[model samples]
Each structure stands twice: as structure tokens, then as C-alpha cells.
Target: MSLVPTVHLPDDLAAALTRRLAATAPTEASAQVDRLIENYRGATPTAAPVLRDAGDAAAYAAYRMPATYAAARSALAELRARTGAWTPRAHLDLGGGTGAARWAVADTWPGESGPRGTVLDWSAAALDLGRALAADASAPSVRATTWTRAPLSGAPELPAADLVTVSYVLGELTPGDRASLVDAAAGAARAGGVVLVAEPGTPEGYARVIAARGRLVAAGFRVLAPCPHSGPCPVTGTDWCHFAARVPRSALHRQVKGGTLPYEDEKFSYVAAVRPDGAGTPPAPAANRVVRHPQTRKGQVLLDLCAAAGDLTRTTVTKRHGPLYRAARDARWGAPWPPDDQPDGVPDSGGPDREGAV
Candidate 1:
């Protein structure tokens, strides 16, 4: 249940980024890299431009692409494990950057041939860069990706797709625009198809995801992950639901971002929902969700669990539990808690915010 995807910035893309950085003086490239970091920290739809030129775009690929790919990859794994043998034939990415979601999909969807996918974004440079990066990708889906330039707010109607992704792009939009983007994504999906949305793991990011979830539920889609029974998000108070994906960064990543952590944990909140008509049958549920990492101590392990009975509580496993204690000891962040257990009745993780069948 703990899915950690292997992400290396694609070879062709890495060469391009290196060339772009080399084209600039070291100081200039570093400054552009610095700006990418700063603008990313402060950017909104109307903010100062971030991905302006080759160097700017390269810096973006360096600092952001790995984490973006990791989050989407993790969410897709969770959805697929539940759905079983489902493979999307067509994909549409609204405001997808550098086609990261396409790569994530190519990794998870288990088709003999990859799906056809399109990436729509406002940055012509980003689209162009996306193409170069994916131009000779090994995955047919990434190679077949079409990058289109479109305004996020007033983009044209989307093509119907088997899978749709809107990742890390909602925070840049206004409230109205976020809702509109969600509507467009929801409308574009075929019945029983999936729509995956990911954002930063901050409280505000979770708030945006919560709003989008409401939109999806109202639009007749059912929650697929992070909730066993979607009656309501049973998690209340200041804590919000989110997940983490750890990804390895390349040498270029160190150069652009400075310092040297070989990897970074990308924290994100995502909702994967299926349109009622197309979702097929619901899968059997995991009995508990590991809402927090297990705390291992001498002869005992402590776990924060969201149970099948609709409660979030702490469970202590001592050496007496043997295998169970070892399993709890080795459990990772964002995995199904005690994966083998089956729920007897309804399941709940968050509180008072959603409604679905038990």
C-alpha cells in the first residue's frame, strides 16, 4: 500500500535543461534558478511571471518536476490498486506543467500500449519544453502527448477522456476559476472514468481540494480514495487529510536548488473520484487508514488510525502482537493502515464534510 515511484527526470529532458543552463553564465542561471524558487513560493495567477524563458523553464523542471510527478504517481497507485486492471485510453491534463501527470499515468496504467494524452497550459514555453522533454520518451503516452497553449480561466471545452488530471495548478487560480477548472475536468471525463487533482499539502491547499471534492460529488462523482465510505470527512478540527511521496532528485536538481538532499518528500492533498455511471463496482475496503506514521519504541509501536467504524484513534501494538507489531513498526507514511483487515461496516477518515453509501 505504500507506493513510492521511481522518478528520474527523463534523459532527453535532462539534456535540454543542461543545455539551457549552460547557455547562460553560471551566475545568470543561478539567479534565474533563485527566481524560480522565489516566484513559486509567492506565485498566483496574476503574479510576476515565472516560466518566461529557456533558463526559467529549465529551473522549473529542476526544482518542481520531480515532486510533481511523485505526488501524482502516488495518488494514481492508490486508485489503481482499488480498481484492478483498469487502464485509461485517453488522458487530458488541465494546466499540467511540463507534462508531469502524463509521465505519472504512463507509470501506473498497465496498458500494453500507453494512452493518448494532451496537456493544456498558458505557457507557450512550457508547452514547447514539454514537447522536447517528451519527444522521444519511451512511454508511448509521453511520446504521443500533445502540448497546447490555453488560458486556464477561459480555456475551451475539453475533449472527453478516460483519465483527467489537474495537478498543482489550482492554487494559481481565483476561486471562481478553480471551480470552473474542476467543472471542465469533471465534464471531460467519460462515465466511470477518473479525475485526479493534487495540490500542496498546506491547509489552504486541502481547503481547495475539499472545495473541488464538493464540486465533484455534486456533479455525481463518488470519492475513490482517502475515504473508505464518503459519507463525511470524519477528520475534524485543524487537521486536514494529505499524503506524501518521496522522490529522488538528480545532480542537476542539486545544482539548481542548491544544497544536497538526495531526495525530498512531496506532501500533497488529492481527491480521486469516479463519475457514478462509469465507476463500475466499488472495491472492497481497507479496514483502516494510516493517517499518521507509526511511532515505534521499545517493545511497542503507536499508530494513528482512521478506522472502519468512523473514528480516528491511536492504537498501541506491543511485542505480544508479534507480526502485527512488526508490520506497524515498518509501516510508512500515507499507506493503508493494516492493509489486510476488512471493514465490518461503514468506514470514515474525515468528518462532517461528505456523503456517500456505506
Candidate 2:
């Protein structure tokens, strides 16, 4: 079952971060944020820790964790929906500074005692802040997290777990390290294990996600979201596949970003891959995915879809088709097509392409 969408940070985490930010001089915190932004935008692999000190870690947790948490929540939501009845008992968050992905996981699978989490990162400061914040978390999984200081180099073999997530960390790695990390992530998937990789929505981030997707597929895993088929991505040229998660900003967030908007949309690209369980089969993915926002015109709705046939196609539904038209109007971007109705996989009417009809 999918959990409710998380638009803001959990109250406990938010309060803890605010307290930490308050302890630091506002100027110092803002400066730390600026430096982190520059480093992240540079997207260069660093030989040393990015969050070099407690101030840097605290500022980052206050400034970026909400967006990272929201993006991870959205990606994991897709994984949950795609993998029916499959629940993770243990999770490993690779390069998971401050355990943002772990927070998302707790929300995704609430009330379950298991899915005990481990957050591994090279930055001791980040891990320390993360541990402090999680100590008061609402989820047992978050509170019981094992905060470990580990480097993401050498493509070291990882411990097998039910779930592994690599979020927003690929950009900081050299090309060789990035591939090695993806390989390690692939190898970490055990019986029915799932791997999720997320990156910024930038072109560079999309390239990283695509490369990881190829590696997972080659490793005998089945893709479960965004892509309806495991074949080559139909998205070509400059167009990239990405999704947006809206995060509510705190006052501190506004001060750091100099933005007045109460919420911001975090654009991210991701892929969720899974291995077969004891049944020796995986759940079926959607027949098609709404790759972009649905466009509604005077009398028709246009849906840009990644169809099950492993190709990009446009489906148009007009007023002539009453029910389907309404569904198309309500359809959201990044959701499966046909609106989960018509479970038989046939629409009320469609053209020869079988995408949709008037």
C-alpha cells in the first residue's frame, strides 16, 4: 500500500533542524549553504568529505534535506506502487548523508517494525547530525537506524538487504566511481531485493540514472516504474525523463534560498529495479506511464505516454468519450495510464494505436 504524500518535513526532524540552525550564526549558516550549493553545482568528484564540519552538515540538513526527503519519498512511492505485496525488511542507504532517504522509507512503510535501516556516508559530521535528528523520529525504523561512517569508493561489495537507495550522490563521484557504485548496488540486491537510484533532474543527472538502469537490467533485475518496459528507453534526443516533488519550505529555508514561495518543486530522475522473489516472478509494471503533464484543450486531453510497446506515443481523449475523457483530465504526470480502471487493459475506445480514442 502506498503511503500518503509527504509535502513537509516531519515535525520532529523540522524542529530539531531549526534548533540546530538557531544555535549557529545566521551568517555562518548562510555561508555554509552557499558553499554547498557551489560544490553541488560543480558536480565534481571530491577526494575529501564535502560536509567538512558540523556547521556544514547542520546547514545542509536545514537547507536541502527537505527537498531531498521529498524527492526520495516520491521515488519510493513509485516503487511501492509498482511492487505489490513486496515489503522490505532491511534497508541500506548508500552515501546517505543525514539519512534523508531513510526518513522517506520510514514514511513509505509506516507501522512496520522491520526494515531496520543503515545509513552509510563518508562524512562523519553528516552522520552525527543525522543520528541526532533521527533519535527523535516517529518511525521505529528511523529511530533505530545504524549510522555508519563508510566511504563510497572502490566499489566495495555491499551487504545484502531488502532495499538499497542511492540518492543525489552520483553527481559527486567520478565516472569510474559512479559505475563502480552502481555495480555494487546491483550486487547488493539479494532474493527479491530492490534498488532505487535518484539524481537531480539535470541532464547530467538523467545520464547517470540511465547508465544505472542499464546496469541493473543487465544484472537480471526488472524495472518497475517510469519505464513500462525494460528495453532501451524510448526517450531520445535532448528530452529526459524526470518527475517533480513539491516540498513545503520553512522560514529558514526561505532565508537560505531567498525565496518567498511557501513550496518548491524538486525535479528528479530515478529508476527502481527489483529481483524475483521465491515465487520466481516479479509484479508486472504498468502498461504505460504518463511521462509528462497531461495537456487539456477545449475538447480534448493529450497524454504523452511511454507505452508498454516500449515506444513513446501520444494518446488523445476527446469529449466524445465521456468517462475516459474525465479520467484523462484528472490524470497526473508520472502516473500509470488508463487510471487503474479497466484492469483488463483495454480502453473504452482507441485508435489503431490503442493508446486512446475519442
Candidate 3:
């Protein structure tokens, strides 16, 4: 499996963060980061804003933003691969504290004018810091992004947009609120729009994402990336579908986390669904999706896949398979199987169950 390159913070944003961190004492920032970690670990259905002040917000941006940005980028990449020629003109990011999703969107479709972006969150501190960070962003979209204060409970109605993103926010909402928020997103998204919900890769996070996926499908949206079919998820019991994004750690991130590692892999579960309102041709789903990293040993490669037939399967490719084996050797988790460039007319190697399952 190919190793995804470590995603780094944009230079402009990195400089902005450096300037913000320069004013705060390292020890104070470190202390606040520890508190944030504690809060996040047990932050389900938070009654109030976790970021209570500028200090807290700044600490969070320094520590969590890079990882969140990476995860969002990975999910967006998958969505873009499936939605060819579909560029969103407007983007709505719900509960987007530091505007990580907006950054991901802008990076995903660069060179274009970029989407008109708006980030809504309940925390004034987070909004303020996000605004400051985006004020001098190199990307025009980021510089022109709007930050608004709003509750996560889907009150006052959300603004209509071509793209809606809910990332790392569901865990902080009650069950009722989570459903309400997703419904609101479905209601506000324009026809042919896209809504992506992402969460930490933990089993609980996967549960939340899966629930949201069902809600979107019920709302008439078609499942895109991650799941090859709109049918029931084949992953059952102890197994959950998830992907990982490697994020390069900034100096402040290392200091705040107190770790020596130069990078961290942020595992995430996500579902990208589109409002198939008949504006364009309905895209075809992938033949299969790589659910796990391809495991290669000797002349054979073992692949765990979620097939379009609505099942989880493990297939093996031996050296004798020629070009197919080469493609298998280059396969990466979360990517479509038998990539578009692979030699045509390759025989099927995806039947029956193997020793491994995802």
C-alpha cells in the first residue's frame, strides 16, 4: 500500500499560528492544551462551549487544527475523486470552530476562484480566532470566508450551499441534536449539493457517522465515497470502516502534546453523500473500495475490500497475476480498487472469503 504523504499546514496559516503563539507563554499554552485533551476525551454531548476563551481557542488551533485539517482533506479527496467536474461554488461548514474544512475545500480545488465559504460555530472565541487566521490566508476563499456564531442544535435554520461539512462536531452533540443537525443540513443543501460528515475513527465515532449516513440516504442523497453502495453497511459487530490521514506536526503541536514524534496519523470515519437532483449524470459507484492497507508478503498481496455487491471481502493477488498484482502492490487504503490506469480486462479476484476480514 502506498504511504500517504504527511499533510502540512499551509505556509500562510502556519505563519499566522506562529504569530498567535508567540504572544502566549509556552507553559500556559501547554497547560491549556492538557485541559483541552481531557475535555475532548469526555466531551460527548457538551452542555456548553469547550473553548471558553481566546487562550483555549488558540491552544486548540495550535494542537488540533493540523490533524483535523488532514482528516478533512483526505475525506474531501475521496469525494472529489467520485464527483468529477462538480465544483462547489458555496460551502457551509457547521460547527466549524477553526475552519479546517474550508481550508481542505480550498486546497482540494485550487487555481479556481474557490468557494464562497462560511463557518458557523457556537463559540465566539473559536470564531474570532478562525477569522483572524483566515484574514491573511493566501487563498482568496479563506481570506473572504465568513465566520458566524450559531448553535449546533440546528436552530435558526442553516444557510443553503452547494457543499456542507460537519466534522469533529457530532461527538459534542446529543443524539437528538445530531439527527436534527443532519436533517437541517439536508434541508439547506441545494439540489445536486454535497454533504460530508466526518468523525474520529473510534467505534463511537463510526457509529455517529453511520447514523448520519442513514439520515442522508433517507433524505434522498446518494452515497458516494467510502461506501460503494447505498445498501446496508456490510461491516458488522466489532469491525468499523475508517481511514487515516498522516499530519506533519508543527513545533507548537509537539510542545503542546509533549511528544517527540514528528507526525501523527489521524484516523477518521466519513461518509460523502450527494443530493442527486438530476442536474447531471448520476455517477457510477466504484467496483470496490480498499478498506484496509494492502498486505504484501513474498509474491502475493492480500487486500481487504468493501465490494459493490454489498459485502466485505478479502482477495489475494499473486505475482503471476502480472499487471493486476502490480496495481495491487500500489493500492492504498480508502482508494478505489483496480485503479483507472490499471491494464484493462483483468480477471476477477474478488470471490469467496479469505483469512482476513474488515
Q: List the RMSD of every prediction in angstroms.
A: 5.1, 3.2, 2.2
Full candidate order by lDDT, most accurate first: 3, 2, 1
Per-residue lDDT of candidate 1, residues 1-358 (tens digit): 3344344554555565565446555566577878876776774766433577777776676678878988888888777866677788999998886878888888787455887899998887777778877865677678889898888785358889988999998988889889999999999999878888899988989989989988888888887776555556666679888878777777667766676678777889988888767344755435567777666789877777666666776767667755666676776656676654422212233211222321
TM-score of each: 0.85, 0.93, 0.94
Q: What lDDT does each candidate get? A: 0.74, 0.84, 0.86
Give one digit per residue, the lDDT tens place, for model 2 in 1-358: 1112336777877887787667877778888999998987674888899999998998898788999998898888888887776779989999999989998998888885857889999999999999988887878789999999999988777888899999999998988999999989888878788999999988889999999999999988889877898999978789899988788889888777667778888889999988767584567778888888887889888888888888888887788777777777787888888766645434544531344321
Which stretches of candidate 1 lie above 4 Å from their native place?
A: 1-26, 47-49, 154-156, 278-280, 319-322, 340-358
Supply candidate 1's per-residue lDDT for 257: 68
For model 2, name the residue pairs that clash. Answer: 89-115
**Which predicted model would earn the best lDDT?**
3
For candidate 1, the 10 contiguous residues with the lowest summed lDDT are 349-358
Quote the lDDT for 357 in model 3. Answer: 52
- Model 2 vs. true fold: TM: 0.93
User: For candidate 1, what is the TM-score?
Assistant: 0.85
Score residue 101 of candidate 3 by CA lDDT.
92
